[model samples]
Target: MLRSGISIISVACLLLFAPIAPSLAAIAPPLNLAHSPITQLSVPMALFSFSGSRPNYLGIEDGKLSPCPGTPNCVSSQSDDAEHGIAPLKYNNSPEQAIAELKQIIGNMKGTEIISDRADYLYVEFTSSLMGFVDDVEFYINPEQNVVEVRSASRLGESDMGVNRKRVEAIRAELNKLEAQEAQA
Candidate 1:
């Protein structure tokens, strides 16, 4: 009797799951590559362009431009102004105090420049962590409230960039929370 009951349960289980097997097997056919192939492909390797990312160290010799070795697509005859300037955001506080606070938040950093400063926002550019990409950071601060908010957009290669973006966003959220707490204090 127990053997028959086990067999009955097995058959019932198989019957219940049988319908799902066909649905699982009904996957769409593989992409019809032969019917329609994406022949015209354009790869935008802007990172390879010298203007895309400027090196920290530039060497010029004998009326010729020489970038450091291992730099990608370093042009020996290009002007320094190949890229667009990144204007820093402004702050309401005096420039000196704002600069101090900015440096304090981001410590021991190199290759950063203050592009613009106003009463509310401060714009800054810094060499990105990526090998050949620069990121622009915009800081909006309320001096009276002693609050600081920072925004930055990063340029990155195709691999795992989404995860990195999320990490940066998490950092932004934490900073914003800190700013709120400071404002409350």
Candidate 2:
């Protein structure tokens, strides 16, 4: 009789507790940053100086870090600006002249297309290699320095994107050199 009574109690206890067991197991461990491993990683900025008598700021093509038109203090960072596809002017050059020069430089390229032309900046589109993958690239040209800067989200990632930006910058640098040579000739 005692054995049967104990069996019934065991079954009752299991039935009562089994429903709560899953909930307890599902509870996530609290985040403890102190115990977690820590280290600092750096993502390289796309650095290029416009070739001129005086090097101008090669402003981030993406809107981030752009100063407000009138409010000097109000500014947004590049990560915030890249997503909206807004290309802010980095230099104080004239956009119309830059567009004219760009037209002259590109010279009937089939895959290239100008997406926006406003003030001193013009945005263009083309297919190019990025992070070892072929990607559609968009960038702005500063007519004063005759420099082009690629603005892509790949620019923000920590992986091979920096190398890819360097590659793009290389192409831009080559083009700038070629244009400078043409201007000299």
Candidate 3:
């Protein structure tokens, strides 16, 4: 009888304290610091304070798209060097039609913001989905050359892990497909 009474008291004490344990834990402050373990474990910010400011060389200069910098994070049709050089998008249609198609393709892409749209020039900002990293992309319709000059560059990092190059290629692929469809139609 004595043991049974003691067991009943222990069970009662546990039931009373169980709900309070979580409340006591909740009294502790939540971690909000950048260096907190939660932040460290989560996805990293795309742009850091140490990353350089956004480039001012976006628009047309000397009848050409902006040249890629020495960094490999950039790729440009106007660049003379092979490391940073990517071929311009070739199209057989009028410059107006090409630009319109380019606009449509860019519109379909995710996280794209068209900053400037002109008859022969276009400036777009592509942001990364994970960390909001921004990449500036420019296109110049060169009807004389029958090619759309392109420049893609990361605004933050020294290297973009070929993101700029891949973006340009993706755009090119889409443009080619669109042009082919138009021809078929």
Candidate 4:
């Protein structure tokens, strides 16, 4: 009878713990490609060519950032449609200082390369860490509006899993934090 009772308790314990085990496994870090033979085989095929063939449509046009393409993969502060529209980054400092701060912020982020840095405009390209997908990102300091216009679009894909939009929002959040810190100082 004692052995049967022990078995029952053990079964109950497993039933209680079984659901939590998969969640823990889900949090485990992805395999390192450097050490794994399977990942090494797949890495080369995933590395897409990012030639600079796309024409630069980044600079200020008609005192606004370029509109997002019809695809959902792009987002712009100047876009009129709700799906492609995002709020411009407002600044409390001069446009020059704000642009400088923005450059610094983009410089600190991973997998980004600044292609052009003009007095009133900045252009950057962000590459995905795993798949090597490239996204063109641009910032135009609109002094007249007291805000910095932004545009981010994927180079090749119809859908970017909201990566471009999230990138802009993340930059906006970081810039806001930086501005608050400067104000306190």
Q: Of the candidates shown, which would achieve the greatest TM-score relative to the real structure?
A: 4
User: How do the predictions measure up, each by TM-score?
Assistant: 0.32, 0.32, 0.71, 0.73
lDDT (C-alpha, whole model) for all candidates: 0.44, 0.40, 0.82, 0.81
Report the lDDT tens digits of candidate 4 across residue range 126-170: 887545788888898888889988999988868988999999999
lDDT of 3 by residue, 1-185 (tens): 23324365665666677668688679978756867676555544442224345677678877787777777899999898988999999989888988999999999998788989999988998887644788899999888889999999988768898999999999999998997898899
For model 4, name the residue pairs that clash: none
Model 3 is weakest, by summed lDDT over 10 consecutive residues, at 43-52
Could you say which candidate leads in lDDT? 3
Candidate 2: C-alpha lDDT: 0.40
Of 2 and 4, the candidate ranking higher by lDDT: 4
Candidate 3: list runs displaced more than 4 Å: 1-53
Q: Model 4: runs farther than 4 Å from truth?
A: 1-52
Q: How much is 136 displaced in model 1, in angstroms?
A: 1.0
The collision pairs in model 2 are 64-77, 64-78, 65-76, 95-120
The lDDT of model 4 is 0.81
Candidate 1 residues 117-169, lDDT tens each?
65555555555332335554555554445444444444333243443234334
**TM-score (C-alpha, index-matched) for candidate 2:** 0.32
| Candidates ranked, most accurate by TM-score first | 4, 3, 1, 2
How many collisions between residues are there in candidate 1?
A: 8
Return the lDDT, model 4, position 113. Answer: 88
Question: Global lDDT for candidate 1?
Answer: 0.44
- Those runs of model 2 whose alpha carbons end farther than 4 Å from true positions after fitting are 1-95, 104-110, 128-150, 154-167
